[model samples]
Target chain A: MTTTEKIRGLILKVAKGKLSQEALKPEARLSEELGLDSLAQSELLVLAEDSFGIKFTHDEVWTVATIGQMVEVIDSRLAAK
Target chain B: MRQSAGILGTGACLPEQVLTNLELAERFGVTPDWIFERTGIVQRHIAAPEQACSDLAIAAARQAMENAATAPEEIGMVIVATITGDYTTPATAAIVQGVLGIPAVACFDLSAACSGFVYGMIVGSHAISCGFCNKVLVVGSEVLSRFTNQTDRDSAILFGDGAGAVVLGGVPEGYGLLATDAGTCGTEYQAIIIPAGGSRLPPSAETIAAHLHYSHMDGNQVFMFAMRVLGNSTLRTIEKAGLSLDDISLIIPHQANRRIIEAAAGRMELPLSKIVINLEQIGNTSSASIPIALHGVLTDGRIRHGDRLVLTGFGGGVSWGSALIRWHSPGSDQIHKKEKNDDNN
Candidate 1:
């Protein structure tokens, strides 16, 4: 699968039971649109790191708010690797 | 080979006053749902102004000894695990022993933050195994409310005041403690800490003015540490016991956060149904959490004879621990039948 699809998969995993797939558009805000609270967002970050073999700095974690932003960060990290 | 030690009985004492999420949210200018969504805590028990850590410890210890059918004179050692002692000098265990009239035996305090109880279990069990004591009382009591910075939402919403105790004594062979795993990441001790009041940063007029006595934590750091350690430490202890996750009937984890527990359970490929989580009603009681949860399940009849359990915790030391136990009911003839068969063979 593509990097976007892979990251979306991780979000779905974190959002399981609470979110629907239709709500996960590229522009979806993790907290507002997708209902990812602080704890859930942290879980998603850890899951994405393990799944994509990438680490996010503290500043990056706070800045990435949308699903599209998370995808971008993961793709860039993968490129750097 | 050393003698096996097991918990004879358990008890817990939560303060009478309750702090609901709504009340706390008002202080931080956030909604109650906001706190619950982030921490999964509905309310926490707060100690009264006149109450101290020793008061709760004494009450819980009395109930534990009563449940164990043990007289005060029967207990040979008392270990109070806490970072919130009544005084910085005198150990809270000493006060508990005196109040309960538990004889002038070995009494001391243990400070591993949230991992205190499991560490106490290891020490108490070893004492029995070495035949140094016939009975040991282990208590985890904390008055975090006293140290909580009400202005800081992060630490204020997550902590509560309470105590839990267990009576430890010899158990039949092949029963009680099976294996244990404990370790510390000293380099990451700052993940959760109180910056002052200790000798390293002794209390002073400057420290008091700066609000240094209150608990401080890096939420993300502790979250990451807990997620990585809780499941791995439990797995290691289970393996050390010559068993697997399937063999454990229940898992009592430190009640830090629901999301942490869920993530740990996910890592183990275990169902949430098998874990005991009580933080929603009591919030995080630190070292008191495990025994409080353990006591709840036992009282509710969720634990049964011969059932294997895993008790695990992670905390401020960046420390982590897990203990594997095969239950053998105290004051009863119900020994593990499978082990009896092995003994016969």
Candidate 2:
């Protein structure tokens, strides 16, 4: 699967079926639009790290505000591998 | 294996006042469901204005000693684990030692935040193994309410005041503390902190006005750190004890957040019933959480002789700790003999 698809899948897992696929636009804010609170956002980041076999530095973890931003972070880590 | 230090008795003291979710939700202009959904807390016990951390600690220590059937003269050390000590200079443990008339061989305070009790267990247990003390009293007491920003809804609902204590003494080699683990990620110390009242930011009028003394936590950071550490730390200690998860009867974790505990338990593939959670009525009592929960389960008869338990916690120093203990309550030998005789009949 594409990195975006994979990241979306992890987000849904964090969401626990609360956010539908269509609502997961690239620009969708993890906290605001997707309704993932700070705790859930952290969970999503960790899940993404595990799912993609990648790690986000402390700085990178806080920088991702939206689904598209998270995808970019994951892609860069995957590329570095 | 040689004899090991184990808890002889456990006791806890929560203040009489209750802070229900409804009261806090109304004060914060939110619905009770909003608070409950986020924290899984129905109510928490709050200390009266007259009560201090040391008071709670003394009460709990007294009960622990009494339950252990130990005289004050027998306790060689007093260790109170708390961040909210009554005074800044003297240790709360010293106060507890004095009040309990423990004739202190040694008295000190340990501050590892919520992991304090587990750290105390490790320290107190080692003191016994190395012949430093005969019996050690480890008490975790906190008045987080004093350090909490009542107007700050996020933190206000998450903390409560309470104390719990355990008397530690040698038990049969295979029936006490098996193994323990503790570590700190100092880089994340900022995640949970009281920004002021320390030498770094001494309390000034400006600091007081800014509420810098109140505890502030990065909820996201703590949640992430706890989820990553809690279950894994327990498993690591279990491994160190030369045991597997199957041998653990219950996992007593720090009562920080219900969601964090649930998620960590999920990662370990451990059922919730195998975990002790007393947060609904206690909220997060910081260092006092694990011991308080331990006392709760023990009082409810949930723990029995020979039941192995893994006590784990993560907290402010960005620290985490776990201790593997085989429950060997006082008078367990008699209980065992009675059970055996009944079985024969």
Best by TM-score: 2
TM-score of chain A of 1: 0.93
What ranges in model 2 sit over 4 Å off?
B332-345
Local accuracy of candidate 2 as per-residue lDDT tens digits, B106-225: 999999999999999999999998888879999999999999999999999899999999999998878788889999999988999999988999999999999999999988778878
In terms of DockQ, the best-performing candidate is: 2
Top lDDT prediction, candidate number: 1
Give one digit per residue, the lDDT tens place, for model 2 in A1-81: 998998888888778889899999999988888898877788777667667777678788778999889888777777788
Find the number of clashing residue pairs for candidate 1.
0
Which segments of model 1 are wrong by more than 4 Å?
A17-35, A53-81, B332-345
Q: After superposition, how far is residue B135 of candidate 2 from its true place, in Å?
A: 0.7
Which consecutive 10 residues in model 1 chain B have the weakest lDDT in total? B332-341
lDDT of 1 at B342: 53
Report the Cα lDDT for residue B312, model 1: 95
